[model samples]
Target: MYAGAMKDKRSDSRLVLEKVSHSYGAVPVLNDLNLVVDPGEVVVLVGPSGCGKTTILNLLSGYIEPVSGTVRREGIIRTVYQQDGLFPWLTVSENIAIGLRSVEDPARREKELLDLIALIRLEGFEHHYPHQLSGGMRQRVELARVLAGDSDILLMDEPFSALDYQGRLRMRWELVRLLEKRPHTVVFVTHDIEEAAQLADRVLVLSNRPATISRELHIEALRPRDLTDPAVIGAMKEILKELGLQV
Candidate 1:
């Protein structure tokens, strides 16, 4: 991963995978997969189960490296998993403060912590422990913690999959709102086509393992996309069709 802009900065690719391929022991997972995510764009990855969607995320986040090809990333990265990584012993405020531990100024740190609390709309629950909050609320704190950092890229792996149908829908809206306030280049993986339609600037459909891009759909609609809108529905249908799930 390259740091700040200087001489010999390769390109503007915020995150990139070039001719990337990986395998698990004897099993091939990804094959010559090439992707480039520009700054501030939300790219959603969708594929059948066990198609190495999360593996791609792990590659981008440097949790693992491709056995072949190159992975290049610029700027700091933070990941939000399906489950909230909140510390049960830490209060909401304290948990968020963990992200700001790098700040040397106490006053600034406290201010930023409170700002993140407000950003996640958990102002009143600042002192509450994780168990005291609902699952959705705990997830919000997880998001807030990530946002509190200076990371410019977010790798989210099925971040809302644990939520109920209604809860998932609500979190999508909340994510759009938060991103509008503090935009980050996001790579989200999900099995939900509707979620991809609602959140992605571009949706990538992957084929079954030895995963490769089957189709790439660009959603032209703006964020907070209307679910019933023709463009949104059309995109969803196109994705389903590409995945051979049109029924």
Candidate 2:
């Protein structure tokens, strides 16, 4: 249920940023930036620290207005942050059920809830609270919650960053598996080049301050890519080079 199983049949979700520029007071961040995210595409943004990666996402999500330019989005949007946003008081099932509240039919709502719980492979942990689950499990639950809704675009801001190394690796593959089932338009921001290489259909590498697309690398390799694969390695190296790092 990453995005496919519950997607709109007429889903035509897209995001476009035209001549976008923004700043905090006098300090500028994105300068004349333009971006387009097509329907059912996964675009990853990578850049130096403080280069306004998250600002781009905020603008796309309409959480903030650009100082100049235009932002256009289509269809429903959902987000998953680095930290899981599950309510501490709610059980795993209840937390996921929150997303399905829009389903007017009681039987349909209950069915979706159970389907999502099984989709995350947490069938027996329905009654478990956030504190009772592991970090990875909690993140999975959070992902499930987002997916339970009718969303077309997923804005992810370092969603797996809080997990340990092993946990991060697992979630990476898990995400690919979910996407394989049903693709959705996703704009993901991460500092990890490996993560970018593994998950992106296209990677947009940004410049320093006043961020702009320094490079756009289309990953031709298939998903669930091996870290050692030539395309993954090549993309990672290219991203490092774009970021002014010696590869």
Candidate 3:
């Protein structure tokens, strides 16, 4: 098994996966993978390279299906990707308005989209196309798109990886702020330890290839995490060790 060790849980979740496994012909990528995202909870998925972490997110977002397992989802899910994945031809307003098709009230839809842009702090750039925005701005627009959808859950795949140092910091803070307003369940995947530490309420650590949960870490630290705190460092090191890395 590519997965080193596994811990099985018996509890139920807002979303549940039972005996979940996936493969391609003779090769396998995930086996008996199990996890739960409680209603309105933020869960971050972390693992070493080639661990199939992104694959897990794709499955949950309905982009793909697990070969074997039962998936139970509460409501719609929206994704915010590292590349921002915005429509190149659409203006910011037009892109964020995609979800408005289901909403019948034109005034209400307009109001909500404007609120989303402001919440992500991308107010003045609403008319700009995706190509005209900066990296951070592009990400903000993508996040706004998700918010506009009023999704029940969010699947984020390394969305902040491409930002500059300060840009990532600001985006992290903004994310925390947005989550505070209307809490939604989230499954975020990232390779950065500190990023996980800062953002996730709970962290799921996975192993290589046929990935399964190797460990779960809860971040009890208050928002605006202290990067220099010894306690935080200890938790990070422990997770690195779980991934078979010497930290």
Q: RMSD to native for every prediction? A: 4.0, 2.0, 7.1
Candidate 1 global Cα RMSD: 4.0
lDDT tens digits, residues 114-190, model 3?
88888877788889999998998888888777866546678899999999889988888877777776456779999
Per-prediction TM-score: 0.94, 0.95, 0.90
Candidate 1, 143-162: lDDT as tens digits: 88877756678899999999
lDDT value, candidate 3, whole model? 0.79
Order the candidates by lDDT, highest first — what do you get?
A: 1, 2, 3
- Which candidate ranks first by TM-score, i.e. highest? 2
Residue pairs with backbone overlap in model 1: none
Between prediction 1 and prediction 3, the one with superior TM-score is 1
Give one digit per residue, the lDDT tens place, for model 2 in 90-190: 99999998888888898999998988888889999999999999999999998888777576788999999999999999999988876665466889999
> How does residue 54 of candidate 3 score in lDDT?
89
TM-score of model number 3: 0.90
Reference-based lDDT, residue 181, model 1 = 78
